[model samples]
Target: MKKEEKLEIKLNVQKESWKSLWLMARRYGMSPEKMLEQFVADLTCGAGSGGSDERDLAERWYYRSFEMMGEDTFVSYLCSDEDMIEEVMELKGRITKSEQYISEVKKRIETGERIFVHYGKADKKSLIAATWEELGYESREAWDKECEEEIREEKEIVSENEERLKEIWENFQRARASQSATYEEEMKKLDEFLEEYGKSFR
Candidate 1:
């Protein structure tokens, strides 16, 4: 796969859970930081039983670094919970394989070029996100502070949470209008979840 620009997301290492991740890290005979890096690489490479679509997997995560969007990106809050790290670890193990990935890989062997498993991703699920953003991002870089500021100003910063919430709500709303996942059965299930869970939130 050719190198394509991606949205970057910076995440802080959870200090409290560092010990636990470190425990796993030490078993590999590496420092906490180094082992964590390797762990991240393996996790993305579909280490566990769950196979992953390599093409879309690249879209979902970066190597140790957060994902990159266009230029006007903004972080609205921090996740203070220690459990978030555990959640991330668990989630990383469940990634699926893709077929839209690049199939050619080049490696040097002593005798000749050996054909090994091409690390190219097998799927292009990332297009979904890129497409959705392209639909609404008008001349705005996905990671630009200026554009994010403008969006904040337009909403007057009543709360960053409001914007984050809407970011998801808007996508689902768009998906619904576009008939992405608005099949009657799914919608009915959603309605059921809403009716059951929504009524309890208050």
Candidate 2:
């Protein structure tokens, strides 16, 4: 194997700026040279190319400090609880609404109550009594029309609920996939950081 040539470069900056960099390096629990090397490497690699695309320069450096940290630990540092909570609440809200709607539909079915149009009748009893034979409806055709209307509405609700369920499932899956991708990217960055940090220590 061929050995790569190493070059030493000296950077000129204001004392205050160097002091700030030194402070940052100390905060990162690494030496100033290692930190500067990382900065150069990061800039060379292009700043938002990795999974941490959303993060800024300072944020990336902060995360680099926890190179050996787990997702749970990284998550705490990232303060992603608000995002997680929002996702959970949205999912719960969707599920609760669906459950409540189903329960109401079941209750109406069990009670034999009118869920759709009243069809000009005061109650279910009157509606049923108003059939063709009872003359409550002008004709059998009129009664069938009302029945068809109710059936159409019931079908519509069923279709709407099916669509709603599908949407909820799709949204949940998308959110989960997004979270996984973000985590995977973060883990990749951590692995790279750990490797670099190890080299710096050696």
lDDT of 1 by residue, 4-80 (tens): 44334466778878878778778867787665444454555533322456434654655235533322111111122
What RMSD does each model have against the real structure?
25.8, 17.2
Query: How many clashes in candidate 2?
Result: 0
Give model 1 RMSD, 1 decimal. Answer: 25.8
Q: Output the lDDT of residue 33, model 2.
A: 91
**Candidate 1, number of clashes:** 38
Tens digit per residue, CA lDDT, model 2, 153-199: 66566666556544544554454443444444544554454455446
Q: Note the Cα lDDT for every prediction shown.
A: 0.39, 0.54
The collision pairs in model 2 are none
TM-score of each: 0.20, 0.27
Candidate 2: Cα lDDT at 36? 66
Q: Which regions of candidate 2 fall more than 4 Å away from where they truly are?
A: 1-56, 64-93, 115-125, 128-202
Cα-based lDDT at residue 188, candidate 1: 48
Error of 1 at 26 (Å): 0.8
